[model samples]
Target chain A: MASKRSNFNRRKSFDAVRAVVNDVRVLVARGLTKSYGDVQALRGADLDVAPGQITALLGRNGAGKTTMISIIAGLLQPDSGSVELGGIDVFSNLDAAAKLTGIAPQETGVYGVLTVRENLEFFANLAGVGRTERASAAAEVADQLGLTELLDRRAGKLSGGEQRRLHTGCALVHRPQLLMLDEPTVGADVATRAQLIESVRSMANEGAAVIYTTHYLNEVEALDADNVIIDAGQVLARGTREELVEEHRLSGLEFTLDAPLDAAEVERLGATNTEGNTYRTTDDRPIGALIADLGSQSEGLLGIESLRPDLETVFLAVTGDRLDEGAS
Target chain B: MDAIRAIVGVQLRIIRRDPWFLVIMFGMPLVIMPLFVDTIGLSLQAEGYGDASGAEQVVPGQVVMFGFMLAGSVGFSVYREHGWNTWDRLRASAAPAPSLLAGFAIPWILIHLLYQVTLLVTGALLVGLRLKGSIIAEFLVLLSYSCCLIAFVLLLTAVFRTINQVNAIVNLGAMVFGGLGGAFVPVDGLPKIAQYLSPFTPSFWAMEGHRAVFLEDGGIADVLPSVGVLLGATVVLAGLAVTRFRVDETKEFFG
Candidate 1:
């Protein structure tokens, strides 16, 4: 249901460009509109992914990040839209599209009754891996996901992090061309999260297109992925971490005075009093120049810090909300 | 097809890895068989069988009763996948819905057949359960009953949303159908209405076929009626299971 009139439209042109760019662009979804009755889950979400790169989907809880991932992973259907996986229409030919993709959902779902090896090979076999290669494939995936030592162990007996690793391992066993991990590191400990992130990075290095959704902004920096900030079921902005910071970062000065300033002086300094003896100013004037303009009131300034750019800052600036809330 | 095979293999492995249930299924019937043999023997004599120890009746009776309960495990397996959080992973496989359900259904059907067959063999050793009728006909009856009840339970699993719902119906089905079909007593010894209702239960047809094979020394022709009924019920239940089963349906596992 996407109109095709604009090739240079600022807001939507990136999706259009990546849609036709190259076969390396493994996934493309346009005008994805899904609703659960009157409550919309995805209100026209557009996303594209290319090989050897990861795109981090950042959003608050219930902001359609999971909905977008679920749609591409084929667990949910959109009311109106088109999904192309490896240049094949995903909805029209889901079997083929499923062949090209793998998804480790936000929830850890391993067959607890089965051994780690069985769990891996079973998923690989379901993904159409050859019987001859299933064993090696399982072993390799196990090693990659730090599950080699626990191959013979029942998944139910493993630690939570180990189980989480196996849950992600099942998806990558077939080495799908396009991999989507929906907040794979949630609830994982430090070592487990590190191992999974490394494994994901290695998979991408081998040319798999990755879509990683996470609330932990630091993990996004680890992947060095393009950041797509979504809110209220719409794509608010998409750019590199630095690009997002440059574009959406709320440049301002936050300062604490030795004592409370009157509202008149607060207005004279071109600032708003935020809390006890704290003032914020979005004026583009330099801190030194503003302090000079402050004149004798500058002596009362206790601390002055520029609000440095970060993904969290960018997320807050673009969505007017924190990403960490309900995201993890 | 590969997806189905893989799922079946996984399901079979899961059962094999945790086989206490099947072991209990096999053992419980053997224990209950001898206890009911003398009582059901007297019931059988009242129905016209002379000098029968009733092991033939009790063996297949326990087999049918326990077999019905065992088939509920198929539904439990489906719900268990949901409990393990693997249902969505299975859905993500892109296999057709019927194939996915078949993945769980096929292995359990075979296990169910094995459950019944092993009980018959055990009856022969422990309680003198002799096969006086055609071996082929008895095997046919067993296979058809296994298929029928497994399909019926799979349909129930698809139609219901929670394990409690499925367990309630299956547990109730076992006792109600078993009693009405005379697994607890003899069908002929029951009152007129119960005798009439016996034909509607799979246990009735199974007991009819087993009795024909054990007491009347009947061959395939004598057992064809029961076999036809079970196979017919199988097709209908399987069709319903296929029609009602949705891979995306969220089945509650524990609650």
Candidate 2:
């Protein structure tokens, strides 16, 4: 726990440097900490999401990603620390902060009995949109999220993906300056995930800062945004995907042999025997040379697989574990 | 104003969609009042009481009961939001707190007024009980009483965590208070302690105010004291609700 606190302090130092360089941050948190009885959910974590940029917050389950978002959204109070959005203190001035932030929480709070249009209208109106404009705004948001056909359908009756789409649309309808989505794409199909990501991208393009939290490394990769990898209630690494991958030394190359090779050749290649005909190798060098060397000697090579360093590898290297473990 | 209207619109929409609310609002009083009048007939005949019409007494009592139910329904509806966790969605919105509270209260007030009118009209047609005072005058009294009741329910909702618990408390409060405050029977028939306690119940003032209108003996000026008590209760309860309510996201309801 002490080590975790120091790591979080280190991440805070990194954010301090970014804050100096970036002046138009849409959301900023400094030394934010929260505890539930003996359970520390967030420990001295710091984060800054710049205007029009998507920041992916990746963590294992119970890594305080949701707690952080909840605090930033003014739904929870941190035990000690400050949070600012659009130059206004979110905790002290909720009315001002409310105008600048919108959140799509992990649990879908969409009213089950209301129709899609009704749900949209309720949120839109709450954002202070006038009645004359609410219907048109609801229609536009529904159409944008591909919820037009489902407008009259009850929200509880929609598929999981459709409900997620509606939840996204509800958050976006207000056009908040900072949007926080907590696991927005969980349980979504491939197509729905792409659709949700596309909507998020469009919102970011419209100059709203986007902070997304997900256990899916593929979402982190798909978002292709600045990354913050949190573990044990503290951010362990913060950088762009390539920068973190480089920092964590996650580059690797692997080759597969079609038939069982002699023990001598496998040992010479520095490959760990995985099982059966499979072998795994992690090397800093380019994989092309290994593939060429294997091709010349073995004609029965059925397939060769190589993985480029990405956020998942960086997360694994930094945390000493896979990103998807224990993620529901 | 916009926030208030928006919230009110949502509440009305919900009330429209809920069949159970509709039955309670419109159908229950219609069924219960006639039965009450008949039961009174049995007792009055057995005891050889005076020749006054039981329907005349029973119908007004049902109107007040309808008003009580209308106001208390807010607790159940708002409690549903707590159950489903949509209350936080509203609180976290950009709307002002007063607007949110007003939006919640307006639908109950309006529906209760509607039910009051239904009881009046149905009572006159089926049971021959005349509305003795001006329609507007009677409505104003009912409206004041309904506002006070709505405020009390809102206060209850802010403190309670579950709709079922709220429902049990609210329905039980309505029944106990309704009986003591003369909604189901005459306050004079109650024990002395209950009679003294009736003044504290908004239903007591409401029943007296309504009875004054039904007897055609007083105008709004004459019932000002009852209206004053009802308004005072509304103010105190509303203030307490606002003070107790917090939109903390860390709390279990929001979390």
Candidate 3:
């Protein structure tokens, strides 16, 4: 157990050092403005995605996350702006940029007539994967995405989760430099979601820049990605989880005791008995000071956790609304 | 080029999975060939064929006419990608519009040629149609006609927004162009107006080449001019298709 913990520390330290070492911007999009008739999709949006990092583009439905990533992927050209992938202009040199990017849109798409393996290889070949290495690459991707068993099955015949996984797998088969996945876990089952998250983490760990968009705050937390909260076609703010949480200025001490406490004891502790077993400090103060004040009473604490702000709270604080709401 | 080749394989696989359209295209022409064989053969006889069976006129005519409609399958395949929500994924590949168009057109051209050839063979077996001229000339006509029709529908696919619109236009165009080009009867039998308009349709050039082979015992030289016109038409239509196709435009399958 000690060895495993140390190994994890080493890996964590390596990630931190690597994050700083490889600071090149994989995607540089600036002043992206797109107007669809009366509805303005994006208005002067700018995004910079660093290599070896997962940047979660958080928003409700109408926040233009899709529009931004679509332009970066070369699926749509911004009406007026510039986007570069790996330093190549995405619009001026689309095919070159396309060679370096992979995107899984909100919708699931695959060739129904082709087998799962065929679908993977087809996209891989399109993205410049050589014919000699495509088969093994497909196998490797299938294994990574939990699709090895269904490789021979027709894509149309797969279950919903399997198909969704394959849809995402096709996008990354060529192992693009930048991967943009738009809510890849929306319809995914528990196992599929976990498998996808693992795949995405592995990709990011290997130094691919990823822009993952989702309305689910939990996905962003699970990814531990840098958060860019966007709304109404603009980026409100961007930071790491701790930075955003701290930036929101949340501070409180919430805990539970092993034994039930009377009102007299709760008042002495100066904590609110929000529920029968839960206790929360009314004032947002440093938990360390509260713990020091408890002194000998600290031994009685069964479980102690700070009321730090989560991603949802940060999103609400930035966007003035929750993340579950659909596009207005 | 690789993107085009890859799409060609995928599109061919998709078409193979849905063979019902091919069956209908194949069946419709076979049924029509026998119904008009006698009357059209008598019509060809009046136009100075010695002992002509209507099989020659009706079989080649139905082949050219229905082959045009079969070309719609290419448009439908392209639109189906949109319906499947795969259009953006394909566009995201950054394949130029012309490559994507070629991918759909090349496979349908091959299939269109096959559709016409299969009908000709079936007509021979079922209606006693016999070859009279150079088989190479007849093959050239089949090749040129397939190329011309495929290019024509590809242009329409690029310009139109929905599969329904393309279908309505292609189905109507097949019948009207076929009639105007003398697929139903000889150009000599049509009114002066249709004969005047006949030369404007690819069907006219196709039927002319087929008749030269079946009626006049023509060699390659006799059919070369018709092939040239068909190829020229193919190039012009392909140019329009390339100009009109937009990679970013969202096409609707049923819209």
Please report the candidate that would top lDDT against the real structure: 1
lDDT of 3 by residue, B1-255 (tens): 989988898888888888998998899888878888888888878878968998878888899889888888888889999998888888888999998898889999999998999999999999998888999999999999999888898888889988999999999999999998878888889998888999999999999998898888898999999999999999999999899888788888874
Prediction 1 TM-score vs. true? 0.90
Fnat per candidate? 0.82, 0.51, 0.78
Which residue pairs show backbone clashes in model 3?
B41-B54
Candidate 2: tens digits of C-alpha lDDT, residues A1-328: 9965776677677668667647878787999899999999999999988888889998988889999988898888899889998899987798778867888888677887889999998888888767788899999888888899999999989998999899888887888899989898888888888999888988888888999988877777777788998887798898977568657865555455667778888888777665668765677656666766565655666666665677767886787666783475
Model 3, A1-328: lDDT tens digits are 9965775576577568657744678888889998888999898988888887899998888789999998889887788999978889988898899999999999999988799999999999888889999999899999999999999999999999999999999999999999999989887789998999999999999989999998777778899898898889888888778667656644466777766777887798888775567677747667788778666677787877775578876776677555783432
| All candidates: TM-score | 0.90, 0.82, 0.87
Question: Ten consecutive residues with minimal summed lDDT in candidate 1 chain B?
Answer: B181-190
Q: For residues A167-232, write the lDDT of model 1, one tens digit per residue.
A: 999999999999999999998999998998999899999999899888888889998887888898
**Candidate 2 backbone collisions, by pair:** A75-B249
Model 1, B187-254: lDDT tens per residue? 87789999889999999999999989998998999999999999999999999999988777788988
DockQ (model 1, Cα): 0.69
Better of 2 and 3 by DockQ: 3
